[model samples]
Target: MNDAFGKRVRRLRLDRDWSQQELSLRSGISTPHISSIERGKRFPSLEYAKRIADALGVALVALCDDASELRSPKMRGSAEELPLYLQNFVLNEEATPYLEVAHQMSQLPKEDADLLSLVIGLLVKRRYETPVLTP
Candidate 1:
């Protein structure tokens, strides 16, 4: 991986106040591997990258700026709407936790995407007809 991505990994790890060993345990990756990734000594495969992202409580896209378009086509509208709603919605104590899950909606499968979209639509208290899906 490039040094910039390594820096991003290190920053995210540090943001959670987690040591490399801690990250390794959560990620199911070895501490040495985690160290290598953080130091830009290795380029991890997508699987490893995904482990790192999930452990960081961030979506895979968060780790890969260039991969923003990697999302599944199912529920594209909801995936696109998440950022807008998050940007404009007023803050409340209860809404904080859901924000993280919403960020992860990009990776959800079609069935889960439908469920989450319903929940998010309700959470936003918006009035909109649901989109029909074609297999």
Candidate 2:
């Protein structure tokens, strides 16, 4: 499970310029243990994995991904390009509603999914373009 997890952790940690000691303090895990994990000498148990993920401010699943978050538009360009609501999407259980919607969309036929996407995009674009009237 941790084939690339260690590298992902190393990348994320380095991205923040955080030392292993800082991560240790934030994750409540010892520095030596973190070193082992980063070196791929050990696999973190699920409990420790979640702890590390939390300490890193990323979803646990993010650690499993091979840098998808690194290329995510939210990290690349302006935030306004993504919808305000999706800009900070947490990749955890709290995002179940969004996850479920995405799952349902995946089940739909390609044309149906595309149409729905277009409609949703247009609606969001129109709403953003509309001016709010003051009372």
Candidate 3:
């Protein structure tokens, strides 16, 4: 599969706390095959992709979606939209505490928003803790 497809599968599997072996068992695919797919060394047929998506409890299209599209310029750098974007990121990272802080930060005066730095620090920490799996 394409790199984006591989990344999406890896992300979904990680989100579900499944190791490659676990996913392979659930999908009826081999562990080595799943690893190859995640590494973008091999592409699954459409039927296999569907099975994998079903095993992950996600729609097939979700596995095909390009996450980078969400990071387009229009989605970045607007003060009014930043909190919403940050909340989504934190939620996807399973950092609910940081999501709550982001919500609270939106209500703070600009001068009192230094705590935003804390939110960033938390996200950075989480990123390092669970490095993105790149294909």
Candidate 4:
């Protein structure tokens, strides 16, 4: 985590033409602390991470390469090529159906599991329309 985060921060800072002292001053994180963090010797708390990210104009999670949010099943390349909704759907497909069905199914009783099932069935059908062939 430290190695990846430090490298990311260093890369971003250099990209912005900012030195460690300048970044520290802008982020309100002391120069010594910034040096420590950039050297992979220390980890910042959530608040500090946010401050640094804001200063660098990057997402807070960019400073952390941990698997839960940033690093898991990673995707690459520019976002301009694809739509944001499609990118998010492709990245989080595993959890989408479960969450959607759970929320919608909560109002129904045991017999209505089929309610969510029917919705999904229709979605699948609509997505792949096949023409009828008559002989």
* CA-lDDT, candidates in order: 0.70, 0.76, 0.71, 0.69
Which regions in candidate 2 have their CA more than 4 angstroms from the true location? 71-135
Clashing pairs in 2: none
Q: TM-score winner between 1 and 3, please give it.
A: 1
Compared with the true structure, the alpha-carbon lDDT of candidate 3 equals 0.71
- What would you estimate as the lDDT of candidate 4? 0.69
Model 1, span 42-94: residue lDDT tens: 87799999998877766666677754433222322223456776545525567
For lDDT, the strongest prediction is: 2
TM-score of 2: 0.51
Clashes of each: 1, 0, 1, 0
| Residue 30's lDDT in candidate 3 | 97
- State residue 32's C-alpha deviation in candidate 1, in Å: 0.6
Report the poorest 10 consecutive residues by lDDT, candidate 1.
70-79
Task: Residues 1-135, candidate 3: write the lDDT tens digits.
Answer: 477788888877776667898889889999999998998999899999989876665556667766532111111222345578665674576776765565456445556777677777899899889968879
Residue 97 lDDT in candidate 1: 68
Clashing pairs in 4: none
Candidate 3, superposed: residue stretches over 4 Å from native? 67-135
Model 4 stretches astray by more than 4 angstroms: 66-135
Cα lDDT for residue 68, model 4? 25
